[model samples]
Target: MAEKASIKCPSCGTEVEKPKKTWPLIGRPARDGSRIKLMIGQFECPRCGRKFKVAVKKERIPPEGR
Candidate 1:
């Protein structure tokens, strides 16, 4: 059984299924287009047959008591 997940895309705001095996995915959209290559698994969007990258933004910790 696959675990249910809810996540939002930083760009395009496209809603997609978050598969359990895709939890550790690492990908980035192609600079020229929407061609995406994932490090965890393979997937493609059904809309335009383009893949969306799993871009992760690290939260910076502000200096405490500065």
Candidate 2:
């Protein structure tokens, strides 16, 4: 496993599995100087089958537990 942590589905609050391939990325840099991390872990809801994004940086709990 690349790394893992707890991350709930924004739509269903279902604890989703964080895969190693799900590398964290900046959602998109703002015209301003600041940027926000986005929900790199995109998934198709097994129940709804709707594409949705989820933020893992905070809940992903790095291996080092940063």
Candidate 3:
């Protein structure tokens, strides 16, 4: 199962949901030999209304019964 991605705000320490819209920033291989893409974007905290950076790690899922 894929894990839900999330990151905390550095200023407010609020658990913010990962941004659905993002641009690729970096690419690297994971320990499991899967290709992982690092995405970056900006988001505003709903509670504090503070803008902050949002980073998300994306990996490809293998076909079922692989």
Candidate 4:
């Protein structure tokens, strides 16, 4: 199973799920469109309604066949 990723609310230290929205901060998609190379995420803390940003990068493991 793929591991789930999460970030903490910098203000409150509460664990939060993936950001509600994301914008490409840098990099571009591979020629094959397999993934987004990099991005910046905007997250809102459900507990305090605080907003924050985080840098995100996509990575994957090669298949066993490789």
The whole-model C-alpha lDDT of candidate 3 against the native structure comes to 0.66
**Ranking of models by TM-score:** 4, 3, 2, 1
Worst 10 residues of 2 by lDDT: 57-66
Q: Identify the leading candidate in terms of lDDT.
A: 4
How do the residues 20-64 of candidate 4 rate in per-residue lDDT, one tens digit apiece? Answer: 999875444455544444567899999998999887655542333
The TM-score obtained by model 3 is 0.54
RMSD in angstroms, candidate 4?
6.4
lDDT of 2 by residue, 7-66 (tens): 665677766665334566754444553466554666665555556665556322222222
Q: Return the TM-score for each candidate structure.
A: 0.27, 0.39, 0.54, 0.61
Q: Residue by residue across 1-66, what tens digits does model 3's lDDT show?
A: 987766777778787775545787644555665655556777767668777766666556433345
Error of 2 at 14 (Å): 5.1
| Residue lDDT tens for model 1, 6-46 | 44443455555552334344345445434333334333444
In angstroms, the error of model 2 at 62 is: 16
Off by over 4 Å in 3: 27-37, 58-66
Please report, in order, the local distance difference test score of every candidate based on alpha carbons: 0.42, 0.55, 0.66, 0.73
After TM-score superposition, the amount by which residue 35's alpha carbon in candidate 3 deviates from its true location, in angstroms, is 10
Pairwise TM-score winner, candidates 1 and 3? 3
